[model samples]
Target chain A: MGGFLAGVVGACAEAWQEVRIHKGRVLLSLIGVAVAVCALSGAVAMSAIAQQATIEQADSAGGRAATLTMSMQPSDSTATGRQQATQAWFDVLDRYEISYASRVFWGSSRVQFPDSVQEAGMTVVDQPYGEMHRTRMVEGSWFQPGDSARLAPVVVINTPFWESLGSPDLATHPTVTIDGLGGAKAVIIGVYGTSSWDTWPSMFMLTGHFESLLDPVQAAGSMPQYEMWVPPDLARELQTRIQAELSGAVGAQGFVSVDRSDWGAQMDDPTTILRVITMVIGGIILLLGALSLVNIALVTVRQRIREIGIRRSFGATSGRVFFAVMMESVVATVVAGIVGVILAVLLVQSPMVSELVSFGGISDVPPFPASAAVFGLVVATVVGALAGLIPAIIAVRVKVIDAIRY
Target chain B: MSLIELTAVTRTVLIPDADPLTILDGVSLRVEPGERVSIVGRSGSGKSTLLNLLGMLDLPTTGELSFEGESVPAMKPGRRDRVRGSNVGFIFQQFNLLDGRTALENVTMPLLYARGPRFWGRERIAADILDRVGLGHRLSALPGSLSGGEQQRVAIARALVRQPKLILADEPTGALDVETGQSVMTLLDEIVREENAALVTITHDPAIAARSDRHFRLDRGVLTVAEGAARNAGRADEPVTDGPVADDAVAVL
Candidate 1:
């Protein structure tokens, strides 16, 4: 054991000496390994963070909630009449004790504020707990039951609508005019933030106020869309009850849409796909790094052929020669890996990188875990061993007689 | 007992695009402990080949070679390495000191290879040997930084560090000028005498050969000793010059 330790120490010393002698070459090799490792770690951390954000968004959007939507049909006899269809669906939900909200979609038209006029789509809701009103509000207050009677067509605008109106002070009293079949008199009451329908301008108003603006014929002809949000325990029961009752109601189209919240389901997911891709790319980079290491080791062995023979002649066994060369490679790789990981962390943790990624909805860069560090070390060591194998064998294979002769 | 013995040893070489070459044929010789012997021959006369065989770096194709009554041909590579380390030390013509290491490090290398607690103080042992060889001031210098004579002295220090029973020098001073070569030979002779170790020096220089206790000539695989020279000479024996051929007559026995 002592001899083995000595051999290792001697080998390390000898390798360090050689590296010092050719400092430029050693530095260049280390740089190559460092760059490769940095790229690998950065890509891995980015992918992990992106996937995590996606899952969080999906969970917040109610991945498991069940919902039912009802729309009135204009072209049917008594069975498809718009008012009758909405009442039929409400009755079914009430019978089943299913929690639900009704939304009446007014047609898309221009909304006018004091300084600006913008195209907006308006959806009328009965309560704040309804699906559309459940959107997170960035500023101002939500509507109450008396807001429909006390205020004249009060509106809750999204960020885009608020921004288009030159960021008006909606906290005091703000009014927006909506141009429907009736003249534009809609008022901005509140400002809210939402991840849904991010590309378009939109606003929300109380269902009673919106109904007051519509003529009896237009209100009867316009379909009142209803959305039923059911808890997991009552979801199937509510869906079945609503479907049965609404099939026979006037103006009922056989359920215009049935959906649960899936806001980020399609856009974001975390799985083995990114990991596999990273592994492949990282594996290729690692392979190239190993090849270069082997090339360097082979050159070193060739340059030291005479020295190897002299050592062997003095009493070094073939095993000792092999071990000496392998140790050099392992030391080089391990040092390079450590440097690479540090560089990667610096890059990912930088304010610039974090800020740039946050614009794309990712706020944090995940840390390189201990498992990753261990993996990097193991990869470096294995690559070093593989790279040194040929050179170590060559060193031992040198004939003592021929070496002396040379 | 003879420290080195070779009987009917033959070494052959097979080369591509050519007939097989016989480097050494049935060469038989023996050197007892504390003896100094020189093998002299022209280039390609197999003198170095004989030295290699004696150094245990190469194997004989036929017959038996022994070191201190143990057969060398039957030794495994590991055993052979042990024997080479413990029993025989070598100095080469080119002074093969590792270029990356300091003179002291090179000298200590053999002791480092020696398997025992004795190797623990190898640095001190190496420094002592270097001091004895007049290289105490050059211990920290690399081979490339030293002159040829200084490098050869370092090599000699390395060979002596193990305290081996026999020293095999293959044209140790062959690359040096005549004056430097003679000085190196004198230093070797003094060191060998001081250590009480046998020395087998292979050289083509008759002047260097004349300084040894016994001088033999090799020609076309045959080793012949000088005729009138005594087989064993006392420390005070005078140099003999009955011509080089006189060495062959003594070996006829």
Candidate 2:
């Protein structure tokens, strides 16, 4: 056992010596490998960041994963029946102790801007809506708990709407008058950020405040979009239960519709498809690198035929020769892998690249993915082994007399 | 026990679409411990084929061959290789020192396979042997920088570093000038005597073979005892055996 271990150590030392002696030749062989590893690791790292961005984009538009949304129409054909079904859902929320749930209602506010009265798009939601939808405030806070009782309705306006209001300071309690709020001035408490495509002004206000001041005619046209977040494993069961409960309670028999409305509900997720594409491309690059490595290793073994013959004459067995030759490739590639990963980390972790790949803003820029580093190293080692096999076998088959005579 | 023995070894090489080429035909010889033997032949006279068989580098096509009284032909290839590594060393006409390696590294090469004490103490042993060869100060010198004679001396140190029982010298001085060749041969002869090891010299120069206890000439694939050279020294008490001898195989040393 000791001798076997020594043989391994000896082969490694011998391989290293050969590498050092022929450093220029080895360097020529490893350029492709370094580039390949860099591309692979860098792609994976970027893919991780991009995947998070995609999920956040989806979450911001719909809710987080496993969100169940429901809607209902009554056999009586009145809005009151649907409202009652929504109330039943709220009751279910309280009964089940589901922490993250939101009622989404879309309406318009008649804002009395200094220039003119502009009708701005507004989403009326409960306090938990900000957390569920990954909402970010640009200027001030989201609707805090107890914000619904401020007497003066609080609203979070987007940049366009905030600019329309002359960008008022919230510390001074700037107010905006609305046409249908029964003459009560609405407090502009926060500014909700919008994406580049959001050319029109938009706002978010507490559901309680919106309902208290809402005109009956405007409320008749809007319906509450009820959504609840549950653990993914329980989503299917809960979806069925909510559908049956709402369908039975509304007396619509089967008129109620309860299903997952968030981007997570989509069967064909774009992020997953993108990830597969990235891995395929990474694998191809790695294979090309292996080809170059195999070519160089073959040439190296051929060049060292005489040296190998000399080693055999001195007592090195066939196993020793094979191990040594193969180890040269493994060591070279491992070093190259390390260098490539470091380069990728340096490039990817830079703030510029991170923000750029995330489309300028992501809720959470994930840390450099550990899987990318591991993948790079593991792939490099595998490639080295594959590349070394052909050369090692060729080297082992060399006849001692022919090689010495060579 | 004899250090090595060969009985009627025939080595034939098959060629594509042609008659078989016989490299060595019915060759038989023996070398006892601490004895010196030599064989001389012209070019293409199968001197190297005999050396290859004796050094355990190649298996005979058909023969009964033994080393240190064990049947060598029947040993597993790996076992044969190990036995050769531990018990036999070779010096070549071209020195065959690894290029780009220092004199010390070249000498330490064999000890890498020595495993225990030798492997662990390789550098020191290599340095000591190089010193013994009077090239200790040049241990760090690469072959390209060393004179031809210094390189051959390094080769000698490498062969003797493992202290193998059988030393196979295949035209060890063929590439050297007369004086350098004579000096290298003297150094080799003295080292073998000091170590009490057997030496086998195969050469094309008869003068080089004249110093052996037993001398054989290989011509047209046949080996013959050169006149006035056989049984001249060492192992005189034992008659040249004609057939197989019992072996108390010790596995491997």
Candidate 3:
């Protein structure tokens, strides 16, 4: 055991010396390896960033993982039929002990923006919806507990809508009049960036306030829908139970169909696809890098044939010769891998890249993943081992009597 | 037991679609520890082939060969390699020192595979050997920058650093001038004696062969006793009495 360890240490030291002596050759070959590793690691890191951005984009659209969105279409368009559906939603929420339930009502209204009224789209949601969608307020804040007590309904408007409202400051409690069923007046509670919205002049308000603005004729068609944030593990169970109960309440098996698809699953589609594509690309780049290393290693072994012969004559075993040659490549590539990983971290995790990827939508860009870095280094070492194997065997086959040759 | 023994050793090379070429036939020799022996041959005389057989670099086609009473031909190739590495050291005609390594590193090569204290104290052992070879000041010098004599001295130091039981020198001083060759041989002789190791030198120079304790000559793949130690004190001033052969008779084996 001791002799084996000594042989290994000696081979490593000899390899390091060879690397030092042949710096020009080592540098030329290592440049290829470094660039290849950089490309692979960079692709991996960029994919991770893209995956994060995709998840965030998906979160803003339908919701994050474990978010079960239930949509019901009633065959009977009667007022009692829709009311029964809404009552079924409430009963399900109550029975399941849901703490983050929100009734969402999508509609449009004419807003009086101090000078003129402009038609705009509005989303009515409860407080949990703000937390669920990870909405950030640029001015004032999302709905507070006291907001429910105010006689006047409060609303959140995006920057474009705020600008359409003459950009009034929320500290003064600006009021925008909505020309709906009763022409209700609403106080502007907060302003948000328009990142999450696909359309300009978008607004958000409480579901109760939105329902109150509706008359009997409009209320028959546009009922407030419910979205509840549930734990990821229990989402499927809750979805099945909710579907079963709603079907039972409506007294028809296929009368009401619940859209229980989690948007998080949809988000994973792009991530998984990107991951596969990136791995294929990185693998090709790494193979090219290995080829380059193997070419240089073969040349190096050929050049050192006489030296190997001399060493063999002076008590070097074939194993020692093999190890010395092979370790030279391994050590060189491992160093190059570390360099490439550091460069990748700097390039991918930089604020400029994060800003470019986020594009004013995703605020929290994750740190450069350690798994990608580890993968790069591990692959580099494996590539070195594989690339150096053939050449090392050739080196070991050099005849000891070749020392007699010039 | 003798340090080396070979009986009825026959070596032949079979070229494809050609008759088998016999290099050595029915050759036998024995070498004891601490003895100095020399084999003189004209060029193409199969001296290196015989050296390879003695050095365990090549197996005999037919022979009863043993090193320290162990059957060498019967050992596995890996075991034979280990035995060769541990028990024999070689000196080449061209002073085949690795180009990039310093004298100390070149001398330390043998100890790298050794176990125990030799592996740990390799540098010290190499340095001490270099100092003994009068190359202590040249330890850091690469072989390219050294003089021929200094390079040969470094090779000698490398060979003896492991303290092997046998030393095989194939035209050890063939590339050097007469003065440098004599000095190298003198140093090799002193060291082999000091280490109590056996020495086998294969040379084409009659003057060199005359200085060994026992001398043999090889001609047409046949070996025959030449002379006893006619000049044991190794007077380098002696003139060659034998006429030179026209052809360079030492065929590379």
Q: Which candidate is the best by lDDT?
A: 2
Candidate 2 lDDT: 0.82
List-wise, what DockQ does each model earn? 0.36, 0.56, 0.56
TM-score sort, best first: 2, 3, 1
**How does candidate 2 fare on TM-score?**
0.89
The regions of model 1 sitting more than 4 angstroms off are A53-114, A119-271, A354-359, B17-19, B111-125, B227-253
For residues A11-34, write the lDDT of model 1, one tens digit per residue: 676567666666766776677776
lDDT of 1 by residue, B198-231 (tens): 9998876666776788777677777767433343
Candidate 3 per-residue lDDT over residues B25-47, each given as its tens digit: 76777888988888877777788
Worst 10 residues of 2 chain A by lDDT: A73-82
Model 1 Cα shift for residue B186 (angstroms): 3.4
Task: Rank candidates, lDDT, best first.
Answer: 2, 3, 1
Per-candidate clashes come to 17, 0, 5
Per-model chain A TM = 0.63, 0.89, 0.86
Deviation from native of the Cα of residue A37 in model 3, angstroms:
2.3
Better model by lDDT: candidate 1 vs candidate 2: 2
Residue B56 lDDT in candidate 2:
84
Question: What is the docking quality class of candidate 1?
Answer: acceptable
